[model samples]
Target: MAVHTLSRRQIFGYGTAGAAALMLGTGAWSTDSAFAAPVLTGNPFSLGVASGDPLPDGVVLWTRLAPDPFAEDGKGGMPATPVRVQYEVAEDERFRHVVRRGSVIATPELAHSVHPEIHGLRPDRVYFYRFRAAGHLSPTGRTRTTPAAGSDPRELTFAFASCQAWQDGYYTAYEHMAAEDLDLVVHLGDYLYEYGVKTNKRGVTTDPKFHTETVGLARYRLQYGLYKAEAPLQQAHANFPWIMTFDDHEVENNWADEISENNESPETFMLRRAAGFQALYEHAPLRRTQLPKGPDVQMYRRLSYGRLADFTMLDTRQYRDDQPCGDGASANCAERLDPDRTLLGARQRDWVLKGFSRSPARWQILGNQAPMGQTDQDPGADTLVWLDPWDGYVAERNRLLAEAGTRGVRNLVVVTGDRHQNYAWDLKRDYADPGSPTVGSEFVGTSVTSGGDGADMTPQGEQFLAANPHMRFFNSQRGYVRVRVDRDRWTSDFRVLPYVTRPGAPVSTRASVVVEDGVPGVQV
Candidate 1:
């Protein structure tokens, strides 16, 4: 807990709430610690404010001083110098009940971004935050802290979304999500893609920078500016605290560790990765401890929402062997059968398994970036599968799934991202046998706007359903998954949008699946 422990004296010193502070607080012009302002142009709060990584005591408030968003230089039109930004958090939407206030330095080293961690606040509380830099004030963001540690709460409601290609369509799904009554939003990855935008559906990327793939820090920043500056996405951020992670698109498409998809030199790919990691950290509402070190950013960590849920947000792309047999669907890929192949790597795999065994929460959520269930592209004797996800790393996936049953984990849910299609899977111990005992449930959410106005059902989805009997449901639609978790049941609604190429698309639930307590598989 840092400045969140606001004293009554500091609150009163600024004079009565909303009265004296309204006049003098407008420009705390005489503070000794305030950094010198340099006639900043436009509104520096163009990207909006966000909060994330909530704890029982605190949350991270994030913003960047980007007066000129989408500047070609990717510096958000800020100078090389750092600026002092002030933040205020209140229990109410109005600043009249302000509880915490502080200043943080937005440095050029981190692309003028600021993340001020507020701590020592009361647990299980809702707070509103905003940022002030130069003469500009940011929009207010709503955030909620987790229930007190070890306390079992009544229920938890949240949503998970992924894969919003800016060129594909608008973030209309996010607009609907922003209005939902939820506790937290988990971004499972693909926050931004790496490729250039050409013949775009939305027709907004006219900049020449959009003609080239993002390779350096500046280009990545420009890409983020294009996406994060969207009003709907920003509204989603301002609506609730987010648990964010990057999949392949944040760096490169289908990237495996330092191995680039186009087979670039390891050294070359590392530079690009470092730039991508830094850009993600700069723009996301993450803790300071999550800052990247070179090409390495440890994103696999556990967060507890009282004793109701344990969310283990994973990094599937950072520590995986390159996809075998050229990384696509193949009928007979001998390299994938190797037991050494892994998606979670060694340490992360072990860490997740251990946490599962000892976790006290009722539901153990693997906030994965890709599918964990086996999806056979072709049925019959010879197995055909995509060599990207856990299906490509069979032994490791089996080991993790088997241990969950062995450890007697209460409720296991693998909420996954990627593949712009919805799937509710009954995860079996062995996919080769149709009768293998069901061990858990894996809910694969479709994209926010990735596949560009997908249909309700497709030929590929039909083939998958026919090939995998354990697959309970499949819908090729564009939207997110709204989930509700309680002591006895967990429900997922496959919320879909008819179209996203334009804007103002209403969402509807295509299907719903329920996983009852003590039951491992799904019930449609």
Candidate 2:
């Protein structure tokens, strides 16, 4: 069994309260060799730090310290070491006049991951922070708390992205996002893949040729450790406080609460599923409330951006009925159209509906795991895929949209991940009718590195778009969205980075979609 043990020398060197290092006895594992380990080797900042769910007066700071990363057991071969981590806030780039300072201890039970909800600061303020353990110092990170409640800020800029498979390509998208100078980032899902790959060389796209899977906690932790080893992804997490949600890939490709009825054993899969969920909580920087409830817990919740927007993040995978294998285009396959079956579940759906009904913000946005807008498969048949997202839950979708329409919630926008493509659509009553009326809006973002399949607009995708007017635009591209929200309008510039298979590739603007307040849909 792998063991986590701390030497007395390291304990003395690190001190009690996370101060600088003291002279220590030297051994095979030293700070110098640890930090200098190859990219794949375990490092202090191996998993990186991230902040998320930013509130007006506070934001959540997250970091996981792994002394011996590759250990099969979570122990990382180090005895339980507790290190105090101090955070600093500053208004200027130089941090000349520090605003807030405090410390939190990184404990081993939680894999040494720290989530300090730094509160009691100016709202909408920019700050800088870093961590120090022993004589070693972590990379300087940039983050800010939201403005105080009831303060009307002039403009808000943020980015949303998802679906990064480490073996697929480098995290070039993260490199661009870190330099975007945005206030926050919204991640729809698939933060890390529970799989591994074998490659010939470094600096190139690798493949898991065989679908290596994650079973126990050790496998999951190592998978996360591998992805965090990327410098660009680490920098992006260090750069901003993120708002994250989980989709299917966090566990498996399209796993629901139970197994797919015909695919696997529900009892066995649920136990594995629970392990995956716990591992995610152990590694990521999410709040206590976001923790898993049992073998499963819903992750759909709401976050607001002052009076500018209200974001409702949803979990579509955990609450839906089994998708049809070959139910075909018959009404049976359209089981999603049944009012009995649900997507958001009762409680989550109610929470979102009530939120939309009461929201006073100009824009009601949804941070969804799958596509909510209608798409075309054939004619007169606006059938949703039983295995895919909204397609698997049609009746529930209609009810949600119907509620929005009836409540007169103007400018309803949904930001989505999964499908590994970018899409802009006009949510309407019907897409197959050809005379459907626009109800709300949706801006679906493409994946970060999942086989940029649709990066180039496909003829089939284009033809589908033409047939379905509700879908204003679509692209199979690898990129993220830079959104700017003001009092009157919101502009999303689809920023595309060059192919990640190649290094230092130049980024270019693929397109831009803009939506105005009170406008139910978007235009070029």
- Quick one: best lDDT, which candidate? 1
Candidate 1 residue runs with Cα over 4 Å from true position: 1-34
TM-scores, one per candidate: 0.93, 0.85
Lowest-sum lDDT 10-residue window in model 1: 21-30
Which stretches of model 2 miss by more than 4 angstroms?
A: 1-43, 74-77, 92-96, 199-211, 260-262, 325-332, 379-386, 452-454
Question: In candidate 1, how many Å is residue 238 off?
Answer: 0.2
lDDT of each: 0.86, 0.70
Error of 2 at 289 (Å): 1.2
Query: In model 1, what lDDT does residue 23 have?
Result: 20
Best by TM-score: 1
Cα RMSDs of all predictions?
8.6, 8.1
lDDT per residue, candidate 2, 1-524, as tens digits?
A: 11214332342223433322211110111233232112223346556667778888777777676756666565554446555555666676576887776666555545666666666767777777766554455677788777555556677899999998876776788888888889989999998776666641125544342235776656777677677768888888888988888887778877766754336555556656666776677666577666554356557777777777777888887876665454333334644556687777787888888987888777788998888886665434444333467766667777788789888787788888886777888887655455767888888888888774235677767665765667777777787999998878888888886576654756667888988887778888
Q: Write the per-residue lDDT of candidate 1 for residues 1-524, one digit (tens) a residue.
A: 11323343332223444322222221222235556876887889899889999999989888878888789998999987757788999999988899998887676767788777888778889999998888888999999999999899989999999999999999999999999999999999999998888668785647787688899999999999988889999999999999999899999999998689988877677778888988998899988667666677889999999999999998898889989988988878888878898888899989998998888988999999889999987757767898999888888888888999898788889999999999998989988676789999999999988879899999989889888889999998899999999999999999999999999999999998999988999999
